[model samples]
Target: MPQHTPDHPTRQILTLDTGVDAVEPGPDQRWSTWPSIAKGQRGPHPHPDWVVTAAAALDTELGVLKTGKEADVFLVERAVPDDPDRAVLLAAKRYRDTDHRQFHRAGTYTEGRRERRSRDQRATQDRHSAWGRSVRATQWADAEFATLCALWEAGAPVPYPVQIDGTELLLEFVGHVDDAGAAVAAPRLAQTRPDTDLLADWFEQVRSAMGVLARLGWAHGDLSPYNVLADGERLVVIDLPQVVDLVANPFGAELLHRDCRNMGAWFAARGLEVDVDALFAEVFAQAW
Candidate 1:
């Protein structure tokens, strides 16, 4: 007989007894969603070694890591039963459906973006419809996932996008395990109090990351210290659903300037002697 879980409405789990007893999933766990979604929904080719693709794996919801205007991030652990070595933690960022999301400035960020299908375009405009809300939710998730994939491939310091199912995006957890064996999320760059040498190193990493985006003709539309994670000495830029195409978006240059100013001011406040104008000029030059 097959058993159904409330969380996963699409799949049915069959608890078949084969000489060895089947391990029934616990209340907080469900079968890994890898085999259910199409391969195209998965991460880029040559998947990272830590990504568990086994059908037998279970995904356990750990807890909420963050909440924002558009989405909420939760900690998830995926592992095969009885295989401790195959376990890995992932940050599951689930974009809220239209009804729940409070992103009032979406239009500002999506100025030059277009829906591929005419129907989708129409639905996105008709926010009152259920279909419209669903489309809007997935749009942000898809955008962020695609952006992370591109940035990671271009050698930027960003989390590896694992996969996206509907509006939920799974990414490589950019944190370390604590002494108690519990995963501790990396502190945001704004929360860190780095010394002189470390501050300079952090600034250099941010400069290099911004350079990469410039080369790609894109800008982290709302970049700030709050959205960057400080994992040891490495800085990982996040919350990139609003990445602007330098040549396409009307406010691209303005957004780029703001990004430079935002990060520059933070560094300067710490006595780093950052020149916002020079930083913007250096990045803007590479955009061409």
Candidate 2:
């Protein structure tokens, strides 16, 4: 029998008389998934220069950034070995399987949405069926990826959607490296305590983003301080899987109003006089 010494806790090696023939990836590192997925599954054309698309690239999972009812977000670094310049950090949001997901409000948000395939439509409606559960699991991921791409192109303050592979959506990480040279996710707006001027600026950013969504006849159906990330002076909206079609969804206006009130209340508590009704009226006016 040959003796082998493990290089890393997550690595495994098999040695033969000839030499080491096979090795398994470490727990955190895996081959780039980009090459296996279809081109159509990739992000929009003219992908950002930072996006790592090389076939030789490897993805190393840093850690989990967030965990929610529908999905969990992980920090992933994609890079080619020995190529430091070709590296980038991405937020990989992986949706839960139907068995684990708790999409309590999915019906309400998906009211105006429909599956293109009749089979999928029928399957999604049959919640108890395995096929239906699988379809439902992927639907939210697909929806969010498409929404991010459209919003990014329309100039909304959204994270760049790098690509979506099944239920895992890879997005541009929206934060700076910390003093320790580690990636730190930006604080949620709810966690920030800003001065009056900065608060006002943040409000303007939120308002501008909402206006863009309104003009597109859509609404961030679940907007709240918790879903907005404050990276320095910049505000980036996240978790838009439930974006509503203001014209087509019956509850669109109601959801839009809630979005305004949610953020307005936050600003109001911080000494910013936010007129929720006025904000709602202004945003709704742009839907036409």
- Report how far off residue 163 is in candidate 2 (Å): 0.6
Q: What is the TM-score of each candidate against the true structure?
A: 0.91, 0.90
Q: What lDDT is obtained when candidate 1 is compared to the true structure?
A: 0.84
Worst 10 residues of 1 by lDDT: 8-17
Compose the digit string of candidate 2's lDDT tens values, residues 168-220: 99998877675666777889999999999999999999999999899988999
lDDT of each: 0.84, 0.84
Write down the TM-score for model 2. 0.90
Question: How well does model 2 score by local distance difference test?
Answer: 0.84
